[model samples]
Target: MSLPEPRDPSGPYRISVVCLGNICRSPMAEKVLTGELDRAGLSGAVEVASSGTGGWHIGSGMDSRAAALLRAHGYPTDHAARRFDPAHLAEHDLILAMDHANLDDLRRLARERADIGDRLRLFRTFAPDAGPSPEVPDPYYGGEHGFTTVLDMVHAAAKGLTAELAARYGSAL
Candidate 1:
């Protein structure tokens, strides 16, 4: 799908990645996407952040497994968990949910602002080979292998999204 135009044309495009809790999938996708944007030379033209639909992990760091996997892959591991604020609908150019549940939460919060509908999408939708199911499965309750799997999925989606951003904004960069 085509990206929505920046809400504020002169400012960097803002993106918020969200999941059930800020400690896992969303933060992983956030850091991975940030790195991909940097690699694509669009880092300065875009801003990335992450939050959760639920408050369970609010104020905590990213899940240990997720942090370790990102560190091993050379991605930064600094993150402070926070809940997704409905006000973000006005602030972000795009809001990506890690799974359908989080998407539903975001959708409910956004019901009052119908104009922002185009900004919402599943994080995996950007992955070229994501197939029919685009949800990024939560790795919180699983073993190390689950984190590894999530990282791979995030990396693929990040690369695809970066390419699209570069195509649209590369000239300015």
Candidate 2:
């Protein structure tokens, strides 16, 4: 699917990545997408941020395993966990959820706001070869290999999304 138009035509396109908890998938996607956008020359044309559906981990750092994997891959892991505020619906061009559950939570929070609902989608949907299930699985309870697997998924999606952004903003970039 194509990306929604920027909420503010003259401003940088804002995107918010989300998951159950901000410590894992969402933050990883955020950093990977941010780096991809920078590499694609859309660094100043887009703004990326991340949050969680639940408030349990608010103000926490990235999960240790998640942080270590990102660091090993040369991606910055600095993050402050926060809950996704419904009010942010108007502040972003897109809201990407890491899995179906997070997407459902965002849609429920969006409620009657059709404009926001249109902007919400599964993050992995941007992956060029995303299979039948595009959801990025939660790696928190698994082994180190789970985190590595998640990074691979995030990297693929980030690259695809960045390509779309570059196409749309190439002239401006």
Clashes of each: 0, 0
Find the number of clashing residue pairs for candidate 1. 0
What would the per-residue lDDT of candidate 1 be over residues 76-163, giving only the tens digit for each residue? 9999999998888899999999988989999999988978968999999999999999999998899999999999899999999999
| Superposed Cα RMSD, model 2 | 1.0
Relative to the true structure, candidate 2 reaches a TM of: 0.97
Return the clash pairs for model 1, or none.
none
- Candidate 2 per-residue lDDT, tens place, 1-173, comes to 77898889999999999999899999999999999988888889899999999999999999999999899888899999999999888899999999999999988888889777479999999898899999999999999999999999999999999998888788583
Any runs in candidate 2 off by more than 4 Å, and if so which?
A: none
Ten contiguous residues minimizing lDDT sum, candidate 2: 164-173
Estimate TM-scores for all models: 0.97, 0.97
